[model samples]
Target chain A: MRDTIARCETTAHAEGLAAGLTQALAAARDGFSPPGRVAALPADRVPPGAAAVRNRLAEREGIGCFVWPGREAERPHHVRPGHETERPHHDGASDDTTTEFAVLLGAVRLGATRRLLEHAVTHLSGRTVGGEPTLRKQLVLGTVADVMTGVEAARHALLTGASVPDAVADTHERLTELDWETTKLLGASGYLADGPARTAHVSRLLADCWVAAPGGTP
Target chain B: MTELDAPLRELRGMCREAARDLRTRALAVDADPADVERHLDSPTLTLIRVASTPKRFRADGSVDDGGYSGSCLARVIAGVELARGDAGLICANTGPSLAGVAVDALGSEAQQEAFYDAIADGRTWTFFGMTEPDRGSDATAMETRLEAAPDPADGMLLTGAKRYVGNASRGRIGVVFARTGRTALSVRGAVVRIPAAGYEATPLDMIGLRGARICAIDLNGVRVPREDVLGAHLPASRRGLWGIGRTFNVMRTQIASMALGVALAARDLVREERPGWSGHERVSARLDAALALLHDAAVQVDHDPDARRPPSVAKLHITDLAVRTTRWAAHALGPGAMLEHPLLEKWCRDVAAFEFMDGTSNIQRLHITHDVATRATAPRPSAGRVTTPTADRVTAPQGAA
Candidate 1:
């Protein structure tokens, strides 16, 4: 399992979390069970990229891609028009949630978040402000290092599985903070409706829908 | 917190009453920013316009509210109450806002008249262009260039682009800062009238503060008459950086006050959502303490407008606190709070704007640390508090005095 996670992290660093996660889901064998031991919804209920605990068991059966309503995605697992019944897929089918999904999603979101920081570093280093590279400024460097530290902290927290509810909640907060801080480093570009900020924002909503509370269904 | 005297206390009560109208229009503006135009005449917005305007320029020429415009402290007091109503709604209102402070500080008698007169009609929107696409808040590194006009009689040619400016597309008139030479002193502000040749502004798609109408501007040799140059008659030293320093110093406290107000609003919403949750005790106590800190910063600005550290500390702390408080509001409302409560969701979005408005948290921290490093050892930030009404006398002339 750790080897699979490391390989996905490498792919996410090179490509993206979605690409890495999709690859892992596709390659896994049919007999495999996700850590959560959670059951899948009906096949039709899943999608182009739903974050359900199903991994390539059948056609288009890769686990990935949780998108809520009114948000952007590469391949949206959206609520169909007049399909209110399937909303638990978007609004969180907490009952279907499992500790394993939280553990896995944390690692996945961190991988994506780390990618955002790399993008920010590239943007800042490429640009010059007041005759100096923005990335070289002491304050900018300090902020970058702070976010790097956060990624580490979040990575450590995700490695542990004790207290599923608290771990999930803490992971959610940590990754979201790192994402926001990294976005600010991109300046006005970060506020664009698309790009790294959008990805980070989607990751936040994805966690909300997938992670469960102490008394939640997961 | 310093005890509010009767007049200031009464002013806060009136603002609290007026804020409900801001809440009434909040969701509508967020849904459709253009809808803000239809609701601009609410009592709360009108009061803000009147209070922000100098007494001599007001249409009614009445200072009915106690010290709403009277002092930095008074405005800070009212800023908190007004934003508590709906920060987005306040940003949505059409008035001589962000630009008004700069014009008041830097404009000459004739220049000030031109600015205020252009926006005399309640319907007119205004813009203050400073931030650029490449340079976030580093105004000193501005690339917008102001060149000599072909014909000296035409004054100057202003050519530059600005981004993240409020009301840029809709503003009939505004002030944009540009550089005439390599030196910082060469930086200057020029007022440009819209509907002229070679000046265009396009609204940017925003994640939040949709009502703010943030935009990107393209200037192609926009003509600026010599008279429109702010601080044209002032000494070279005071023309550029000085007024910016003064404007930011006074404005920071107000920004902090409004940010604190949003924090309070989020706290109240959590209470409203969970009627008997004692988990909020720690949050409430912290908010109360932040309010005191905000008031202390306001007093400090009133006492010495150029004091940078107090405002920096206040803005940095409260901006992040407001964002954190809104997040707490979501958590307290339980899972799917954002999906369930539209207002809380909108607030979470709107609060992010304050973090980037004047400066980001990183920038604010730099200011605080830079100032602390320069100063000798001193009392704590909250020390030497001045509670007297007279301490609020800095901007009193605007109060129909």
Candidate 2:
């Protein structure tokens, strides 16, 4: 009786694996843009067009593909991917996905910067310092430059697609530094507004960007 | 200041005095900042004491034709004045006045008379309970259920829990909204005496607005008589959650006025703390813009009671400004601002509540955006007819002030 039950369980497992593989292969073949569609391959049996497939998965799954490394003694189990992974897939995110996230982060930063700048202009206009638009102009220009640099970095990284370039990595660091400078320039107002008062609205942008970056994403 | 008419000038004078007295009382209170009695006794309640009387309620359940004193504009001025003293105090008193406004808007002649008669002494507190435990900005999606009793003449049985009910525990009268059926659109409203059997109200501890006894109410088969069900004969669209749109046309402006007052208070505090603070062009400009936004909305509301967009825009802008201004003020006073001046932090926390209290800021923007889109897509008037923009078309002043 126990042997029969074990046989039935093994059969069910094999059937389920077959069904999942069939669905995943079909998704990969048709380029599944919707979530929850992922295909797995043995580490030793990686396909020839692995890079292209990884990029496609990153674009569709947002966080990128999974590549589970097999243990020395144990055979790998075929686990299916859901709409969202429990953790960042066991493997790293593609450079393309990182670049995409950087662009999104850049947009959020720019939006927040513009909101504060507009506020500054309105507030300063009525003060004694109202005579000079120089400081405000300079800050605005600096922010615009930061946005442009971020966009350029993202475009380059996306075009490259595979390994993260040194410039792209540096650009992400620079953006984080720029965020610090922004908070300082706006002074305590920016710090409080982004931290406690507005529920970390400005800080959340940076945090989200970090989540999509190299070390954090995987 | 612009030239004011005689009646408006008089009304403003009364409000100014009330505001001055209220501020004086608030400032006199000792280090125990959470003193609810001080807030209750604060002259901010002068607006409520004077405005909640039977004389203010006409025979037909409408406001008396007593010039600006009987108009929403008067309440707007009073709200601004009360808020200047303390936003918490304004929040506490605002609930009672809102209840009065709801009664005037939807109550029958006897209902209004009963409410006014009960509150004639000026100490009686009234409240409105629409938001439930599960509902926030989308209060229309309430879970509080109302069912018909066995006898059609016996009224409905209400069973549900309401959260964030301002003044619920302390107040005698309440305007409560409950879902009548399983459908999303089946929400209805009824007025009831809260201390009645099966009705339980527990005061909630809050981060700010301490003066306001925000409560959680559990209505376990609370009976709501047929006559007390607001707009019962009216269709679903004209009553309960749906009908609040009409009520908000007036209430939004009052809320804007309160927010404006808080912003003004924050501005004054910052300017006083750092004498050189106003020298910053950014600070000055921001204050001016905020004031301009408030004035624009006030003008629109004063001209036409039914004007929608201006009040919402004002409410949205002023609430944001109030929060921003308070935070800015605290930071301007150096690192120990929170410790040195507790009022700044208190005001900041209190003003933050306004964003979610009336309706979330996102909800306000959504309504405004939808209204703008709807108007834009609406067919233009017949050819050869010239139509003026809403801002330009000035009708007879509302509130008869």
Candidate 3:
């Protein structure tokens, strides 16, 4: 975790760290406050050090990050000390079981969602699996989907002080490339089998999801 | 009385009333084919009758409010607009109506007024007898000649055949252009209106635009009165290239507008039938795209009719789009649309016909290339010397005489 923090130097990097920090803080029961004075901190702050490396990473990747708490009243900084961060205590054995159940359930949900999306995209494209055309389609859809997945994963990874901005940006670049590829394919298809509609729908879904993902908004 | 004030005002009111009545009838007969045809055909005849009289007066040497502001011009334009509103009607009456207008434009003032009064009274359909059997695009190469005799009593004798002479069979007056001299340098345009007995009109069968009755006219020694000559009663100047250019510009834009109307009708048909198809999603998107392109082209020509190259380009683009879009709609609608229904098949034929009408797509391309190349190589005029008028010829009709 300290190694991850040592790599980040920007606000996006810090917010990435904050996301991981959130999970860690939740685990540790220690109230987590981002370093630096709250009032003076930029809206999107990364941790100190690795400035040159972080800038290079941002350029290479397409990630950008901005903090968007649900409401000003419920902001992390505004939470009351004793009243906030409360969870019902459980017996040790029950707590462990609950954690295991949560992990397994999350894995299953993610796997199912990925499979459904893959099936839908393949059906829409009318390309055979393992063929050159299908392979190309898969590459485009996978690259975009993976970038979105990475952004989501980075939020939790930030608990361990990972550079969330770099991860989010890299995913964004891949997503943009995927969008271009999809539109070109659809245009070339001469709109066979409702290709334009499918292309438009997927583009809109990806754009919306990208904006909503942690450290992914431009 | 002023030439057209009362008559034109009356014509305007009648046209508006007729147009309104037709629109109501069209909507009421939306699903009834026979009723729609009846409603469309009647108003069309009325308009044609109104338009045809002007040409007869022009041929008889009577009306002369020089060219543009003449009562004949207003009546002709109004008739064209009304005819154009319904494709079936335009297909039926345009040739005869245009024949009348053409005579007024190119005929002698005395001939003009005579034809105008005749057409106004519904006595005759005037024929514009310019096009020859062999000379179509190249009018100067016309073999038909008029020979003048040295003897004063002999007068000028017109010999040779004219083809594509609209309203020739039934017209009382024929405005024929013949080569008074053989050589290209000696080519001259003469407007001669022959009595029906002096000339023979043979109807020519053509594909598409079935309603416009076209005929090949054979003028054999058709003698005209010496005073029947248009514009000072002298031979037309061979160096009048500018007049030809202006005429081409106006005619091409008018044809483009006609093509636009047909394309729009096709689009409406497609929209109506689209929802029932399995490929509705894809078809709708393409339909939207095609409509946008058509609208852009229409607006460009409508806003600047004299922009020259854009009008031809728009005509080509819109006509091509219409052909493809209608073909798609036909495919989507399946066998039902493929049948002799009013919507798809006839419209497809109409669009295809329009593409070849005023100028072929190839000709339009050549014009565009030539215009571009000429502009590029030509010396630039000083800034203040080059002025662009804000008024568009299409929207603001000129009152020139």
Candidate 4:
């Protein structure tokens, strides 16, 4: 069980890194040049690709537009009514963006848990504890069923969180606990660093989840 | 001990038996989406067998044992029971049953013999081709047209298309709703044989209820014999506009019953998996309230066939509860809920259809509010309370009353 969880977690981490690198490469191809380099250029002087990327980021975050100096642009205004001037007009996350982020976190969490359950099902079905399959098999099967139920709850919370404000926090908390429980179920092999299963480790998945989670450390 | 419970108990038993029968097949259409695509071309016989059970159908093509009027409520109970087993199967069962009710209630003696008799054996299927791409619950706005054919013997020529017509691809016969004139108010029903010339059906890809066999039906000047016209010989009031309404009167209840079945199934699973869920005061309270509303709707369906408000109220409340109950079940199940539990996910998706099909929950609300407001103005001894006519009091033949 431990080895399987470690395998899943490693796989998620590698996948996340690959995705991040791909996005970075795409941004570079679009002339954003990554990091602090693009911010130094004038809005109009920026390459079309860079400008396009900026616009997409702005729109998704509910920043409305890249208001170069005093020039305001028409975009979906996501700024809260009272804090319009208190926050950066181009970087402020709107309620919609927050909900989107919550949903994204939920997706990552669900993917990891799905892998965990699949591993458990495969592993437990093949192996037995104490040289007997009956009681241990029942226990494993029952736990997996319970996990299935929890995943559904998390899914509902994630879906509702997309529209309901309070639901986001509820789903985030639910998902965080799910991640922990899955990791614990697999034990030391799940914590193993250099094993053949290290590639499937869940640390990256957990890290990404934390970064996306409400009140996340990152 | 109530009149409603007796029949409901029997219907429930039938539904459970059918569900057990399907489980034995282990089709797993719900667990694997690929099975849905595969079955689209060749529908599995599981649902057809369930629908055909001697318990559901009679030798005369009418539902066995269930009375003509009371059959509506009985079907509702059966739907609830079927839903508990598999919501996709409910779709398949109701697809034909919907057409049966319309034909039995509105078809001429000859029409009934041809259409109903064919399905009496439980092996045949019928489709209700009413929803068009542009028109749904407001079916009066349909674009499908039935024009007077050039030859009198050719009957009516139907042109235009129906989308989301359940069982159309595999049905032996279908009842199509079309505009008799250019005006929206001229809409009427026509029965067409699946094999008729210029008629085409294509299976639709659906998010849920894969077994329902939903399809798009196109009629390119499809000719229907005059005898196939749903209410050709009936009086104006009992045939066209009024006929469809009576059909809905029973259909709406059955739809609500299907939704209730999904909710009941969810509630049962939640109870079994999380036995302590009922111990939670708020959860128990909600369950009690939902069950009470469901039972109240069932009782109203059996006792008050003519009254619009009871069924409307029942449908409105119960469908909403079905969605909520499934969500609650998922919530109770927790993180593991994401695991593919075919029944839970299917029920959730199936309940969504109830909210949209027939008169939408919003439309039901509109009717209920209108009734309440209209009642508020009328002066009488039963002024505050609304009293519906008993089932026998209703006079219209079973079309849209």
Residue A141 CA displacement from its true place in model 4, Å: 48
Supply the global lDDT for candidate 4. Answer: 0.53
Total backbone clashes of candidate 2, pairs 3 or more residues apart or in separate chains: 14
Q: Write the per-residue lDDT of candidate 2 for residues B1-401, one digit (tens) a residue.
A: 22346776666666656666655544323223335444554444645455544464422234222245545556566566667767666555533477776777777778777777766655567777776554443554567888898888778888988877777877888788778875544666678785788899887655455566677789988988878877755655555544565566677777777776776676677666555534335765775676556556666656665566777777777777776666555434432233234465456555655665666554566556754555588898899998655442212222211
Rank by TM-score (best first): 1, 4, 2, 3
Tens digit per residue, CA lDDT, model 1, B77-147: 88889888888777777777888888988999889888888887778788888888888768778889889
Show where candidate 3 strays beyond 4 Å. A1-218, B1-41, B48-85, B94-96, B149-155, B182-194, B233-241, B274-311, B340-343, B373-401
TM-score of 2: 0.58
Q: In the order shown, what is each candidate's alpha-carbon RMSD? A: 8.3, 19.6, 23.9, 20.1
Runs with alpha carbons beyond 4 Å of true place in candidate 1? A3-97, A212-218, B61-66, B372-401
Q: Model 1: clashing residue pairs?
A: A95-A217, A97-A218
**Candidate 1 lDDT, A119-180, residue by residue in tens:** 99999988887689989988789889999999887777766632355666677677878888
Interface RMSD of each: 8.8, 21.4, 26.8, 23.9
Of 1 and 4, the candidate ahead on DockQ is 1
Cα lDDT tens digits, model 4, B17-55, are 665544432236544423443332222234333343333
- Candidate 4 lDDT, tens digit per residue, A1-218? 22332332344334532232222222222311111111212223433443322221112212221222322242212111334475334322234543444344445445556665565466445533434542264434566667788888776666555556346645655654554344333422222222212212222222221222232110
- In terms of lDDT, the poorest run of 10 residues in model 1 chain B is B392-401
Candidate 3 lDDT (Cα, whole model)?
Answer: 0.41
Candidate 3 per-residue lDDT, tens place, B154-180, comes to 566678887655446656664666665
